[model samples]
Structures are given as C-alpha cells and as structure tokens.
Target: MSLTQRSSGLVQRKTATVQSVGADGGVEERDDEGYTPDEEEDHDSKETRLTLMEEILLLGLKDREGYTSFWNDCISSGLRGCILIELALRGRLELEKAGMRRRSLLNRKVLLKSSNPTGDVLLDETLKHIKETEPPETVQSWIEYLSGETWNPHKQKYQLRNVRERLAKNLVEKGLCTSEKQNFLLFDMATRPLTDGGIKQKLFEKVQESVLSRWTNNPQKMDKRMLSLIYLAHASDVLENAFAPLSYDDYEVAMKRVQELLGLEFDAESLKEGANELMWAVIAAFSK
Candidate 1:
C-alpha cells in the first residue's frame, strides 16, 4: 500500500468518533465506547498534526514541567526507533534483505534508498546520518548510536544527550507546547509545557483502551499505530504513565496483556507480507 493509504486509514479511525459535552459538566458519548465527546474532538483535531516521534515525545514529557521524567532513561533511543519506523512507514527506509554471509540478526543493516525529505528537521537529519554512515549498522545499533548511548571511559558509564529538549523545541514550533524560562537559583532553565490537554488525554485513552480492552481481546485486529505506541511506550519505560490512573484490577490485567503481546513472535513469512513489518522490526529491535 502507498504511504498515504496506510497513514490515512489509521488517521481516520483515530478521529472518526465525534463528541459533544452536555450540561452539568458531563461529557456525552458517541458511537465509540469509553471516549467522551470532548476527548473524541481532541483526538480528531490533533491525531494527524503530530508525527509518531512527536507523539512519543509528548507522552514522555511531564506536563507543566517542560521536560521528560529523568527516570525514563530509555526515551531518547526509543524516540529514535520511532523515527526509523515512521520513515519506513513513509517508504523512505527499509531493512536490508538477508544475505548468505551469516550475519547476526542484530547486525542487520537498514538501507536508505530514498533521499525523500520528511520535512521534519530531526527526521531529515537522522535519515541523512543513516544514508551517510559507512559499513551501516543494524536497527538496534542505530537506535543506541543515535540516542548517544556511548561508553564514556572517563566517567565509566554510558552517556546520552539532550534529545528531549530538541524535540520539545520542535513541539513548540508546532504550537503544541509553549516554552518558558525560569531561574534555578544560579541559572535560567527552559521548559516546554503542553498547551493542549485534550489531545494528551485522548492519547492516554487510546493506549488504555488498547491494552485493557483491544489487545487483551483481539490482538490481531489491533491498529498498527496503536501497537507501535504500546511497544514504544514500554521500550521508553514511560508506559506506567499511561497505566497510572487504572484501578488495581485493571492494571494487573493490562500488565498481563502487555506481557503476552511481548512474548509473541511473528513468522518470517508473515513479517515479509504484512504492512506492519516495520512494527515487528521495532519489536525485535527492542526485544534484543
């Protein structure tokens, strides 16, 4: 399928449910269960505005704090993985076909045959890096390398850079977030707080419904974008944010479902034939 075809279908499904708020501060529900009218409207308005990377970055970000949680250490690499998947979905990248050289799965390279610009600066820069690197690395290695997961002999630890700040600035440019500078005793710190609460709430609901309801019952029928979101969120270690509001029983069930999904293995033939090959590839990259 064409990129437009694949993306348009998912975008439509995300925003199809229209909603309205009733008096007494109660939200009216439309055809879709578990979504209020305002939430549905929010989803409709912003679902297609942000790229997958932006959405993942938004999820990792802390509201009003202007930065992602320090505890979610894997988010930088996870966001890079999101960029790769988004580029693959857009037909700008593809996995190099297996050859007779007996290479390790983790060493498999990503081929950048298309120079098509995604128009997003971060994504374009990443694409250029992939294209220009010599003796290209596998998806897993690329994720680590791009996230600056490099060994520091001086500190004797792995070091990462400020990917969150860069992406946050991009979000600010898109008007999804506003930047503010605050003094921290000795220095001024910049922060990007979300300006749209409705979209974030809708994104949370989508993940919640997928885990507690959709994936738990019908994994095969789940939307690829939703699947991508679940895997990326978990890989980034920020999935708990999505599950924080659930009841005890619901949380237990959601965790169990996530485990089951993670345990699944896609057959080689199936992976080659499906539109979600990039999704499966991402799962493999994180699983390793």
Candidate 2:
C-alpha cells in the first residue's frame, strides 16, 4: 500500500478495532459506546495509584497521620485529594524521568482537580462556615456520605439530596459552584459517565493531540497543581459514559469543579483521556 493508503488503512483498522468491543464483554457490532471489563479493570488500577498519591498529598496537607490513619483516611475521605495529587505526581515524575532538574520540579506545584493554594485553609474556612451557617444534620450527613459511612440499598435518599443541597449551597457561597446554567450543566455532567464516540483511531488522534498540546505547555504558566486538575478532567472526559465533546463552558465548569473538589486550578487542555481502545486498554490503571 502507498504511505497515504497505509495511513488510511491504519486509521480504518483502528476504528474497526474500537467498534468491535462492547460493554458486555462480548464482541458484537458497536451500537452503544462503552468500556469492557478489561478496560474497566485497567482504569481501576490507574485510579488506585492516583488515589494513593492523593492520600499522600492530603496527609502532607494536614501534617497528619504517620502511617495507620493514612490508609484509613484515604479510604474514608472520598478518595478526594489523592486523585489530584496522583495526576500531579505523575506529571512531576514524568518530567523528572525526562531529565528535568529537581529544583525546577520543586518550585512547580502540580495542579490537581480539587486544589486550593491554601487547601487546608479553604477546608477550614468552609467547615467553619458550614458549622455556623448550615444546620448540623446537613453538615453531618454530607460528611457521613462522603466518608462512605452511609449506605442504602435504594440509594440513601435523604443523605444524597441533603448533601447535594448543602454542598451546592456551600460551594455557591464560596463562588465554587454558582447557580448559573453553566454550573447546572456541569453538575449534570459530573453525574454522567463519558461515552461520546467509541474508541476509534480518529477519536484517539483528536484526543491525543488535545492531550499532548495541553500537557507539554510552558510549565511556568501551567503549574503542577493545574496540570493535575486538567488530568482529572481528561480522565473524566474519557469514561465511555462521560465522553461527550464539551463546550468551552462545559470544560470551564468541569475544570472549576475539579479544582474545587480537588483544590487546584487546572488547564483544560492538558491531562485528557485518549482514544476509546487506548482508554479501554488502560482502564485498570485509571480506576480506583
């Protein structure tokens, strides 16, 4: 085949490859887009590592727990900070592996999805305000649900609604989640999984281009904290159920939520999830 034909053939082949895989663990015609079990497993592994890193950072954040409470709190704390830290650490480690100087790395902060320059301070303030402003049950229920302390076979109705309302309210006050249409779209998006296009080569190329451009930017402008947040956005974008092409507004809100949730400002372009098949191939690595 000519080089052009070869390239074309490769793209076609990849597209077909993605199309063959289905959500049910059986090879069938692609109708609904989703991940297979293998992909899901890989995603979990990656997320597990990321979660570990997040826990480490959160531990660092509070200067708490020498050893035992670390693991327990990681499990209990919504696996929250770990995801952002994991992405930042990964970026840092990647830069180091590429021979970037240690000092340069130290000066740069990894921006995770939910980072605040003064994370502990923000949490302290948010908590204090919560204590003063909201009803005690509202705060307690949010804490309980987030800690995995609440369980209902039918989905803890009161806890879910109450926590959502309280957090939404708190976030609104903090200018984190406003009552705008954009915020509402983002809130809806957060609950849904990404699944726009199946893992085809064409989609992969677009995503990969987007990822590389975002990731390899000037570190001076885009710090590690923001990079981590971008990374979570990228990962969130790749989930089969979550992968709709986001409008700039959607992207902005998503990024903001990640920062609010993870406590960091992030670049929207960096840290994207790649093609459907590649995503599937790496699912075990990304999921917690």
- Candidate 2 residues 1-288, lDDT tens each? 000000000011111124564457867442121222222111222111112222122222211111112223322232223222332232211111113442222223222222222222223333332233322232223334333457743323322232223333432343222342213444531221112112222232332233333434343243332333233333332211122345556445444433342332222212333221111111212222
For model 1, residues 227-285, the per-residue Cα lDDT tens digits are 77777778877777777777889888778787777777643522443444545666678
C-alpha local distance difference test of each model: 0.65, 0.27
Model 2, stretches more than 4 Å misplaced? 1-79, 82-122, 125-146, 149-166, 174-212, 217-222, 234-243, 246-288
169 in model 2: Cα distance from truth in Å? 2.1
RMSD of each: 11.3, 22.1
Candidate 2, poorest ten consecutive residues by summed lDDT: 1-10
C-alpha positional error of residue 147 in candidate 1 after TM-score superposition, expressed in Å? 1.6
